[model samples]
Target: MRKIIFLLFLIPILGISQIELKGVLTTGNSGTDVWEYIDPNNGKIYAVVGGNGMSMVDVTDPANPVEVSHLTSVPGFDVKVWQNYVYCVTGGGGTAQIVDISDPANPVIAGSWPSSHNIHIDSNGYLYASSPGTTIYDLNPNPTSPTYLTDIGTEGHDVTIRGNRMIDAHGFAGTYIYDITDPSSPQFLTIITDPDITYHHQGDFSTDGNYLYICDELGNHPQADITVWDITDYGNPTKVDETADPSATPHNLYVIGDYAFTSYYTAGFRVFDISDPSTLVLADEYDTSSATGEGFAGAFGVYPSPTTGNIYINDGSGLYIFGFDGLLG
Candidate 1:
């Protein structure tokens, strides 16, 4: 049950020297979901932020992003980019929006779904959305028209699909796993809970799918900021490790290669070396907020570009970009 904890909200000391800030594209007072889209026609990458509406940023020049387009819609809480379309999910009795990104500069709303929130698109082109229950959508061949597949009874704070299994990080209710092979008819498998966990908000599987990184979004005193589970067996997940800073509240997390990136609401951005999940180490961090008690006024989500390895972070204030030379291995 060992963990790493600290309290610093402004330019916290760098744990390593490899992390760097390349550029930033600032947006007005907005929060939640930072996703990236790469234009296939011109090879230019676009950074998409969801809030108040959808803002398309040309991160082609990481240091100087041009806001080519802004499509006003419901304030979005989550955004996903697949193929030539950008999918945005609005929480709080919101809808899902599908925008065609074939032309990054002129994105048009392709389609939308009613009653959707916090949607996750899997590798097989299946969209998993959460509300009181989980709703599945199949987006293939054409991104605009997503066919509703099935719905699961159990509700989740966040959901992700890997292969035929669905991982649901259900706060208070713990983490639940489901068999999603049937897409339209999912069956509950198991639920894993830890005594020290407060709120299980979201989770990300390791590259090999052997471990699950769970984020705990505690408002006041934190029990654990992140609880790692050995999910080798989906039926029975064992608590392997945990990490958190003093007075920490984690928001979103994404894993890439040997590293896992997280955005702590007040603690700013954190990078962890997950080569060894049993003894996860804090790799690096960048602080963007001044408040420290974790009341949701800092980094909201971290999106690392698959094409360029640059990190895109969205906070309540603005959007930022960070870069790394290479792994510390």
Candidate 2:
């Protein structure tokens, strides 16, 4: 384990916060999305850092994360973990790399894909690679060498799976839903669109799966922050509510239980109490960047670990680990 300089209590740049900065690691490269993986053999948690390339950090100790290994074979703009494997992409034309991380201390590239923009692995161990559009691959038998399954030709930016549902965020096309009960053949459900939608970047479902929350990546667009929809009727999604911080650009969103966590480009990491979708409340916020005005120059990604109870976020500076003590029951 390398010597990790812990920046224990750095104050937030903006409002009072219920979040505490535990530790951080400067990856040297501007960071993007991050994925967590718990080593089954040892039960140690690791954070796969994405950016120009990808690196593995032992976050089992949140106060002192140690960079264990890394791979520069591909530009990792997005990353996801399934079992003992990692799927990553450049969000461009660069080939996607499949890494075997059975040993967190020594990860190795096991295989490759033609290209990918984003990657997601469902509970069934199926890999959904968004290469502008969407392509499904089976990670069964061997996670590294994925077997081609099917393709949803609807061009999109990202894809997410929860239970039997799949949500594909398609910029101006809005968000599309599909029945992924059969991972190989996704049956199109319906497309959720609203006149105010600028860019459907990414989103997550509420705990009950009756509501959907989406984030629009356009910073300057009016009301493009976060939008909520009543997804109880898959064929007819109704826009229920919305919330935004006009000064920042919203990126990705992830939901766990009653809270929705988001990464704002210049605003930093924000947590929303989604118990009432119609009236989402800002539970806690911590500005991770000093740069003012939004143009994608701040927190790039955020991941609230359900297992470790630690929040991981990446900014232009590097990775910041935090613990959120505030939550509205």
Candidate 2: clashing pairs of residues: none
- Spell out the clash pairs found in candidate 1: 5-245, 6-246
Best candidate, lDDT-wise?
2
Question: Where does candidate 1 stray beyond 4 Å?
Answer: 1-17, 27-30, 219-222, 326-329
Give the residue spans of candidate 2 off by over 4 A: 1-17, 27-30, 219-221, 325-329
Q: Write the per-residue lDDT of candidate 2 for residues 38-139, one digit (tens) a residue.
A: 887788888888887778888888888888877777568888888877788878786888888888777888888867778788888888887578889988
In model 2, state the lDDT of residue 250.
82
Candidate 2: Cα lDDT at 225: 84
lDDT of 2 at 204: 88
Report, for every candidate in turn, its global Cα lDDT versus the true structure: 0.77, 0.80
RMSD to the hidden true structure, all candidates = 5.3, 6.5
Question: TM-score for model 2?
Answer: 0.90
